[model samples]
Target: MRTIQPIPFRLLLSAVLLAPCALPAQPRGPVGSVRGTVYDSLTRKPIVDAVIEVQATAQITYSDAQGRFTLDSVPLGVQQLTFSSATLDSLGLYGFAREVDVTSDTRGVLLTTPSFGTMYGRLCATAGSPSRDSAIVFGTVYDAASRTPLSKAQVSLRWLQSSEGGKELSNPERTTATGDDGVYGICGLPADVALTTTAQHDAIVSGAFNTVVGPSRMLRRDFYISRELGQAADVRTNATPSSGSGIVRGTVRYERGKALPGALVSLIAGNRSTETDAEGQFRLTGVPLGTQELNVQQIGRGGVSRAIDVTARDDGTHDFVLRGTTVLATMNVRGKVGADQAGFLRRKQDGMVRVVEREEILKRSDIGSALKRLPGLRVAQKLGGTVIEATRPMCVGQVPIVIDGALIPNPRNTTTFSVPQALSGTTAIPRATTTPAPSRAAQSSVVSAANNARVDQLMVNDVLAIEFHPGPASVPMEYWPGPPPQCGLLLIWTVASNWDK
Candidate 1:
């Protein structure tokens, strides 16, 4: 160039650095993408908001409402795609993963939760025969109120199986512990048989969650647990298992056609019971939590006993199917508390106690209604059942109930259960040292939970008479089996007194 002779080395370097000429394009490694859809194995429905990750890499994407996802600029080569979501995380399930070749956009990739095949492979790996005869139970245990996963929850499963030698055997109880993910699984269970399962965490335990895995051999049951009212836990004590209670509502009907009205239902060994309404529907509350046996009274059918698993999140529903006539009849006192008609008349004529005669009982629909006829009693609708208390308004608005002189146990006696043990890997609720004074609602709820809805079980036809003692002064020794209640006693006269039992 002009005057370029004898240019300095420094000047030549500066010119090259300042030059605007384009050099050969630098090379880059190949980059690809991943596209796929996520779904639920049980429902076979698309799962939205699932996060897909290119493992060991920085690329990540989330599925849309349609469960479709795409990840661009994934380094080309073999890559691991992981899928996780709130739904999966809450179940304590680690996300699913797959190895994918990422030479180009990997499209049409489908994913799902642990499918039947996958679960089978994992559960039945050591089981014999690779057959679908054995069932697999998998689910998450969670807090009933918060709906959050409960870590370290214990799930108990019990089932009866037939052994190879034609012998009926009770399988060793299968129990599994849940991790922080609250996920649990049991494999190789007998298919097409009823299995009872319960979940427990510290002082909180769920009612029985009975399930049946048919020939399909896949059961997904999500159990919910809660601390029942009247239970108190202290960090100093080991949490005892709760015999939690729940409300069971259902209808009785003839399997062939319509509702069976006036049908009587009672919890076996539990006085908290009820009778079906005119519509054949009944709502029974405060039944103990767990697998409870129910006795249904029907004429000529014998007393039918049915097993129902009472859960914390009870569907609040049940349906009883009867085969015979719906022409309701008198209750069977086989093992129930009944009355002595002679003694009832004797008490009535003595005039020492307030007596509700059959003529009055027959006019009302149920005993609770008949009890309302008494002037010294307070009857109020609460928690889907009739609650009776003395007009004195003491004793927290509840009185100990007696039927046929059989004193029903008062739930208020043991209002406090044990606290959480805080076992390893378990996330327990913290014990509160200080609590605000309970509101009236709280007070009412405690009373309601402690009192049984006895009105639902006895219809007017079943009762010959009823007696009420308004105070300790009037509670006779025969009626008050235990310490005389401050609020007095109620003696219900049934068709057959337990004296016959």
Candidate 2:
């Protein structure tokens, strides 16, 4: 009683605070957690490595091998999620990219497996020609000086682009890099078009103290199909479509003979949808019969998805056992050029010429931009004229230009096929020449000559690739002298635009 009368305000505060502690503690978080398995509708099983991305915040989680996934700390709110796999994960006409939503009444979500598009064929240097075995071109990438493989090296394939010239132009297009094994291969590429690869390495290696690193190099090679790469017979035996309502059946098992229970599998129609199952089995009925893709999801491990074909049938059975997947190596082509590598070659409206890959080519596509991306290339005027053109250092390096197996007279001449149009603010006035120009000239002389002539039927898509040969230093002794006894650059361009008809 000694201080009670004097502590009216302080005592009131203590009593108020004590009343709240006296009440029970509030519950932590909501009680329930959403859970479910993701599977392919076509192949009945769980989908591993399928990303479950939250739509609200864009936060993401991945499914496990058992096709099971958990989303912890999912606050009570309107939530949406999606499933997506890598581009190369399947062989359907399309790939998987699906979404789902969850709310107060929704506690779980089941994701259906999606299909993937395919790009299936055999590797070769020519059609109907003897198989090169290892000589078969798989993919291109820049490798280390000691041949050690890197990842994500710049690579290209030839495709079409729009140019001011109103002619089909060929330009190197970008593609994936090598795996850890210094190899890269992909499908779902443009069909019926021949593709070649060019790889470049951009690296710095010190030979001695206080000395600069060795100059990096670029490597490119052209290859084509020999009618035998994948003949009708091969397709028939290896790939068969399902029959009866277009449904297909398949099972996933281990190389050791164990069924991958709960493994997510899918049948990739050209459109990229699928069916999956709880067991390691699948039945995709009513699926289109076109060459379909069969992909199995892999969790944790990074590599190519297992692929198979779905033929046109009423119903059929196909089995798959995936081997070890491959990881691509990286490359560095920081300081180099390639055959047909252009420097934005174009004509100015005032009769002045300007080489312009630095601006014109890059605007169209990233691959075309690479023509002038390298540091080794220098824009040079042919001594007496200001017509801008690209030239490599005499001892530094030079790129070879080839069209359909035969080499083009000059790298600048080859650019016509890739960069068919003129840069913005420039124009080309065609000059009529009475006689056909020489198809092949001395490589050395062609690099030094200049003519405002364009090749007939220059189309980007038709030319397969812009192959880069690192001068004599990179070529083996066997390919020296004049043109090798065999075709070096295989041309896949159509002689006529309507040739297919």
Quick one: best lDDT, which candidate? 1
lDDT of each: 0.58, 0.33
- Model 2 quality (TM-score): 0.21
RMSD of each: 24.0, 25.4
Q: How many pairs of residues collide in model 2?
A: 76
Query: 283-344, model 1: which lDDT tens digit per residue?
Result: 86665454434556553332344555556566667787765523323545355332355445
TM-score of 1: 0.37
Candidate 1 has its poorest 10 consecutive residues by lDDT at 1-10
Per-residue accuracy of model 2 over 437-476 as CA lDDT, tens digit each:
3344443355343221222223333332322322221221
Runs of candidate 2 exceeding 4 Å displacement: 1-28, 35-46, 51-73, 79-155, 158-194, 200-501
